[model samples]
Target: MSQPPQPPQPPNEPPQGGFGAPQDPPPGGFGAPTPPPADPFAKQPPAAPSTPPAGGYGSPPPPPPAGGYGSPPPPPAGGFGAPQGPPPGQPPQNPAYGYPQAPPPGQPPTQPGYGFPQGPPGQPGMPPQQGYGYPTAPMHPQYAAPQPGGGKKFSTQMQIIVAAVVAVLLIVGGGIVYSSSSGDDGGKQDEAASAGTDGGEGKGGEGGGLADGTEKAPADTKSKVGFQLPHPKVTDTTVVDGSWVTDKAYVKTGVNEIVGYDLAKGTKLWSIPLAGQVCAASRHMSKDYRTAIAFQEGKPSAADKYPSCNQVGALDLATGKLLWSKSVTSASNGDEPVRFNEVTLSGSTVAAGGTSGGAAFNLANGAELWKPKTDTNNCYDMGYGGGDALAVVRKCGSYDEPQLTIQALNPATGAPLSSYNMPAGVEYASIVSTKPLVVAADVGDTAGDGSSISDFFSIDAATGKLIVRISADADKYAADCGSTEVEKCTSLAVGNNRIYVPTEEHEGGGEYGDTNEIVAFDLTTGKLVGGRADAGDRYTLTPLRMDGSNLIAYKRPPYDKGGQIVSIDGSTFKETVLMVNPDDESVREAETSFSTNYAEFIYEKGRLFISEQMVSEPSKSSSLDDKQFLVVSFSTV
Candidate 1:
C-alpha cells in the first residue's frame, strides 16, 4: 500500500550489526571506533536494473561534484601511487634491474639458476639447489655458525694445508730425481776405483792394473832351456872315471871304460880307468884338461888303517899316460884321519882341506904347503879366497852355543892373516862369496823363540875388516818355514853381488824340520832384491861361478832326487832353471837324509857342464852305493 511514502532512511543512522546489514559510516564520524576493514579491491557486484525514483526523490540528488565523490584522495607526491622513493631506513632500489629479495638472516643467499622449493615460514626464500639435482647440503656442525671472522680463518687454514701438501710432493720428487742420477754413475765409479788398485802390467806382456805400478818387460827375452839327462851306455862295469871336467867332458878312471863322449851324438871317444874314490878335472882346454886330482880313501886291498891319501897326477890330454904323481899327507900325524871335502886349483897352485884338522897342498910338486890348526875335529868346508889364500870354517863347541871361527890362512906358508869371531850358539857358518869382499852368514840359536836370527857380515878378504853387518829374522823371510830351531844352513849360496841364504822350518824345541826357501840379499847394501825362491823340499843352493854377466847356481831339489843348474842374470836378478831331473817328482818324508843324486854343475867358456848321476836302487839302500854319473852340456844362445 502506497498510502504514505516510506520516509527515506536517514542519511546518518548507525549501521546494523547483523548479516546482510548495510555497511555505512556511523553518524558520529570517521573518528568513531569501527569494525575491521573489508577488502577494498574485491570484485564488485553486478550492476542493478534502472528504476525511476519517487516524485520527490526522482529529482535524485543533484550530481555530486567531481571532487566530492568518495574516492581516495590523490596520493601525496612521491608516495605509493607515484614513482616513490624507497621506504624509511631501506636502501634505494637499483633502477637498472631487479633481483630476488635477499634471504633472511642465517640462510644462504639465493642464486639465479638454482630452483628452490617453497620453504617453511620465517624462511622467505627456497632451499638452494645443487648441480646434478643434488640439494645444497648444510655445512658440518663444526661450521654451523656464519661468522665472518671464522670464514677468513678457515680460508687461511686451507691455504696452509695446500702449501704443506705441495712441499711434501716436491721433497718426494727430489728424492726420486737424486736416486736416478746416482744410479746412472754407480758403475763408472766402481770401474775407476778398481782400475786404481791393480798394477798396469799383466802376465804375458799384457797390461794388468795392479795397485802399485806397471812392471816393465824383461830386457833379455830368451826363454829358459831345460837340461837333458845323458843316456850313458855302460860298457865296462869297474869304471871309476866318473869325474866331470869344467868343459862339460868326462874322463874315465877304470880300464876298458869310455873316457869321453860326443855329447850331441852320445859317441864314445876314448876309454881309460883309474883307481880313486874321488876325481876332479880342470875345465881349461888350452891347459892340461887331462890332469886329474884323485883321492883314494883306503889302500885297495888292505884292512890296515892307512891314512887317507890324495894324489895330484898329470896326464896327456890325447893319451891316458901318467905324466907325474905327487902325494899329500896331513902334517899333524899319520894316525890323524884325512878327509877331503873340497879341492880347488887357482892357476897352478892346488889346495885341499882335511877333515882331521888342516889344509895342505901343491899343484906341481904335491908338497905339504901349510897346515892350519882347527880346534873342531870336523872341517865342514874350505875354499880358496884368492891366490894361495884359503878360508876355512870349523865347529868349535856344542850345538846350543857353538863357536864358529873363520880364519884366513896363507896356503904357501900357513900364516894366519885375519880371524873374526861369530855370534855364540850359532848353528851354521858359511862363507857365501869371496870377491871384492867376502860375505859370511852365522845363524844364531833358535830355541823357544818363534823366530831365528841370522847375522850376515861382509869382511875384507885381505884385511878382515867387518865392512857390513845385518841381522835378519828367519821367520819373516819364509812363511811356511817355522824358523824356531837350529837349522843346518848349508844351503847358503852367494853370487857376484848377492848372497842367497836358505832357511828351514822348525817347531820350538823340536828337531830341525824341512821346509826350504832361498832368500837373496844385496851383497853391497844388504837390501832384499828379487822374490824368494821356494823349492819346497828341493832347496839346495850351491854357488858355481860368476860369469861375465850371470851368476851360476846349482840347486838340488828337495829330497835330493836330482837338481838344476840355474843361471841368474846378475844385473836383473832373473833366474833361468836350466836343469831338472826327468823322473824326479816332489816327495815328502819325515827323516833327514843326504841326497846322493848329484847334478854336478860347472860353468866355463860361456857353457854349463852338468853331470846328472842317475841311480836305480830301492829306497831302503843308500843312494850313494849304486850311483851312475851321466854328463850333459848346455850353452846360452
Candidate 2:
C-alpha cells in the first residue's frame, strides 16, 4: 500500500487551498466509497473546467461518448465477481471507492505548483478513500522483519543460523545487476569519490526496451477487460511479486505455485507448484522466456512461520517448468546455504545476494559460478542490479561506519570490469539502470520523502568512472527507489541518452485538479532537455518502462475519467495514446483502485496487466464482499 503523501511545498509556493489542492476528508475517512453517478449518459455534460492554456503533445481528450463509454463492457468473468451491469440508458453507479468531488462552481484553480499537502487532507477534492497517496516511512526490505517478542537465547550454532536468517531478511527485493571481483583494490577505492572530473561524451547504452526487444504498437489502441483474478485468501500479507509475459502465456506467482494463463481467454494453461513461498523474483527474463526467482526452503510452520529465503531457481515462463532450483553453502556462515534476500539475472548468470554474501549460478543448469568469499573487512555483496549489464553493491567496513563499492562485472565470470567507491556517509544506493550505470541514493537522509534518492550518479560502466551527478530535489521530481532494494526504482525511465522523470504532481492549469509532466535530463551533461510530455489538467503521468527507444507511461485518470496508456517518442517527446480504458463506473473504479505506488503494471503487445505485489486481509472497515483483484488484464485486441 502507498505510505502517505510526503514533502511540503517548495518555499516559494503559497500555502494550501488552491486548485487540485488536497482537501479535508468529509465526515468519514477517505476510504469511504462514493456512490456512482446515475444516468451517466443522460446527465448533462459538466461545464468545461477553467484550465489555463498549456502546451502538451497529447491533445485534450475528446468529450465523453454521448451514449456513455460504449456499451457497459460484459460483466467480468469468474474470480472477478459478478458486478451488476448498469440498466439501459443509465450510467453505472460509482463503486463504493471514493472519487474526487468537482470543485465548487466558478472558483478559479491555483496555478500549477509542487509538493504534497501537510496534513491528511483528501486528494484534491477527493472524498474518503481506503488507500494512501505517496510514501511516508520507508518500506521494509523484503526479508527485513522486526525481531520476535520475548527474546530467547540460543546456542552458538543456533545463533549462527539465526543470524544468517536475519541477514537474509535484511535484503530488499532484487532488481539490481551485480558483478563482483576480488577485494584487492586499494587504489580504485580511493578514487571512487573523486573520479569523474568531466561528464563523458558517450551516450550511455542502447535505451529502454523489453527483455526481448521493442514491442510493436497494436493497430487498435482501444482496450477492454480481458480477465481479472480474485484475491487469494491469506492469513497474512503474502508476497506474490512476479509476473512475466510470453507469446503463449501470461505467467504469475501464486501463493506457492507459478500459474500460466492463456493470453486471450485467461484460461489456465499450466501450473508449477513451488516448494515454498516466493521471496524474490527477477525483473529480467531471458530471450527464450526463462527467468529467475528466490523462494523459501519449506512451508511455514508454527515453529518457523517466516522461513529463510534460501532456494534460487530459474523458470521457463513459456512452458511453466521449473528449469532448476538450488542453494549454495556459505563458506563464511558455517557452510549453510546462503539465505538470499534478492535474485537477479544477467546473461546466463543468476545472482542472489544477502547479508552472509552473494552467489552466482549458471542460468542454464544451475552450476556455481561464484560464492561468497571469506573477507576480513566484513565486506559482503549486498545485492546486484542486472539488465543490459550487471553491477553489484559491495558493503565493507564496520557496521557503524560502512562503505559501499559499486562494481560493473563480467556476467560469465563474476569478474569486476570496473568499480566505483561511494562517498562517505551514503548507507544505501539503488541502481536505477544497469547498462547506463545510473545509481540513486539519498546522501545524509535529506530526502525526507522516503524516496531514498537525492542524487543520481551516471557512471561509465566500462571505466568505473562517474559521468555526471544529477541532483534531484525530492520536492521537484516524483521518482523513487526501494530504500533497501538496490534495483527497485520507479517513476523514471532511462533511454535515448537521457533520464525521463515525472515532475511532482502540482496544482494544474484547470480550475479544479492537479497535473504533472515527464521531463528528461541528459545523461552526459546532467542538464534538463527540451522534450517534455505533459499529463494535461488533473492527470498524472508516470513512466512505466521503455518501449524500445520510446518511453511508455501510464496517465492516471481524473475522478470522472478512465486511465490511459501513452507511448512517448524517444527523441521528439511526443505522446501517442496506446490504450484508453472505458469510463464505465465499475471499470473505472476497478482501474483506479490499483495505486501506481504499490502495484505492478506491465503493458506489452497491446495488453496491460496490473497486479498487486502482495495481499493482506482486508481491513475491518472493508466489506467482506468488497471486490479485490489479484491480476487484472486489459487488451486492445
Candidate 3:
C-alpha cells in the first residue's frame, strides 16, 4: 500500500540532480503520512510559451500516443510497491509537471501553453534556483473544443478512481477584482420561498436542486473570471464548509454567518447570522433550495480553542434565512446536546450523527423526530448518509472490536427497513451512496495511499443483501472517502447503477504529459463497463458530481494551460467541454490553487465556484500584501 511510483518526467527536460534527488518510498503504513520534502522548485520561475499556433485556443489536440492505455510501463524494480516518481518534494523532471524547460538557443522566451519558453541557464557553481513567475501579460486560450470521438481504449489492468487536493490561493496585487452589488430585491426574496418542488421522501438522496444536479450545457462555453472573494484573515483554522447556489444567489458559510452573493456578478446579497462557525454542511439541497447544517454551540474562547459541534439547523438559501436551529441531549450523555460530526438532508428530515449517537429533526421547523437513547449493547449510530433515502452506520460491540451495520432507515420514523453487516476488522466505512447503498472502506489497512478505500460494497438497500463487492487496488484507482466522515467522499460519481471513477494519473498516450481517464464499474455485477473518457495528453480528469445520467468532471490544468470542465455522457462516455478557463498563468494559478481534496467545488449551468472548506492564519512565507480567496467564481458567456 505504499505510494505508487511517480511517472517519469517528460522525456524532453533534463533531470535536476542534487540534494532533493529521488528517495526510497516512505515506510508503509495505513494512516501515517510521510512528510513531504522541501519543494526543489519552490523558487523556480514559471516557464514562458513560444509563438501562438495559428490553430488558436480551440484547436484539436495532437494525435494520442501510439499505444494508448493499452501500453503499460514496465514494473518498478521492486514491483508495484516500489516508490514511484520523485520523493514527495521532488516533482518529475519535466516541464509538464512544472519544471522549467529551456528552449533552443537564439529563441526568445514565449508563453507556456501555446509554445515553449527558453531562458538563460543558472550562473556557474550556485545550486540552480528554479525560476517561478510567468510573463505579466495575459493570454486567452480555448480548451478541449467539443468534437465527435470514439471511447478511449483501456488497459485490462486499469481501474477507476478519482483524486482531489485542497489548498489556499494567494492573490497578489493588480489581480482581477470582482465587482459587487447589493442582492436586495425584496420581491424576488419572497418568491424564493417556494422556488423548489417537493421531491417527496424515500425516492433516493442523489436528486436535488435544479435539474437534480443535471446542469444543461450552455451554447457558448468560453469563460472568464466572474468574481472572487478575498480570503478572510482568521485567528486560527476556521471551518466554513457550507455553500449552495440558487436561481437568485450563491450562498456560502462565512466566519459565523451564512452569506449570499449574486450568482453572476459576485455581489453581496444578504446574510443570516449563526450562533457559531459552521462545522458540517449537508451535500444535499432540497428542491426548494433548503439545506441542513451543523455548527458550534458558541464561539471559541482562549480557554476553549474548539467548541463542540452540537447545533443542527436548516437554511432557506433563497430568502437567506435560518429556518430553524436546534440541539438534542443524548440519554447516555446526560443533558448536554450531542456534538455531531456530520449532517445530511432526506426529504423533510435533517439527520446528524456523532460520538454521542444519532438524531433527526423536521427540516422545516426543527421539530424533534428522534434522539439517541441509552443502549444495553452500547450500539450507537455513528453517522448517516442522506438524500433520497436515509441510511445509518450503527456501531455496536466494544471499542476494541466494533461491529458496524449499515441500515436503510425510514426517513419519517427512524426505523431500519433493511441492513447489511460489514466484514470484520473493518473499523470505519463510508457510505458512498445511500439509495444504491455503496460503501467504501480500507479493509485490513490495505489501502496505504491515504485514500480510505480498498474495496467497495454494493448492497441492496431494500433487501439488506450484498449485490457485489468490487476490490479496488489503492495504487490503480483514485477515489477517496473521508476516514471519519461517513458522507464525505469525492472523486467518484454514482449513476445508471454504475460507479464512475477516474484512474490515478499515469504516463499518457500523447507527448504532452501525464493523463487519466474516467471509467465505470457495474454496481450490480462488480465488473468494469469497458468504457473511458480520456483527459487527453497533460490533463487529468476528476469526477465532480453527476448531472442527470451524465458525469461532470474537471480537467486539472497542465503546467502551462488553464483548467477545463467537461460533461461525459453516461452511456456513450463522450465528453463535451462545458467551461474552459483562461490559460493566462496567473489566472490558471488562481483557479487551480485550491487543493482538490479539501476545496468545495460547485459547478452548475456554466459557472464553476471553488471555495475553501477551512481557513487559517497565513504561513510565514506569505506576505502581508498577499490576499487570499474565500470563493472564486468563473462563468461562460
What digit string (tens of lDDT, one per residue) describes model 2 on residues 462-512?
Answer: 999988787777877889887667777878999988888887775443335
Q: After best superposition, candidate 1 residue 327: deviation in angstroms?
A: 3.7
Lowest summed lDDT window (length 10), candidate 1:
190-199
Per-residue alpha-carbon lDDT of candidate 1 for residues 223-308, written as tens digits (9 for 90 to 100): 22223332244321111223444233444333223256543333455655444433333222325553434354433344532224
lDDT of 3 by residue, 143-252 (tens): 12233574433211111000000000011111111111124321110010001111011111122222434665555566788898866767766677878888889988
- Models 1 onward score TM values of 0.44, 0.69, 0.69
Report the Cα lDDT for residue 585, model 3: 52
lDDT of each model, Cα atoms only? Answer: 0.37, 0.67, 0.66
Candidate order by decreasing lDDT: 2, 3, 1
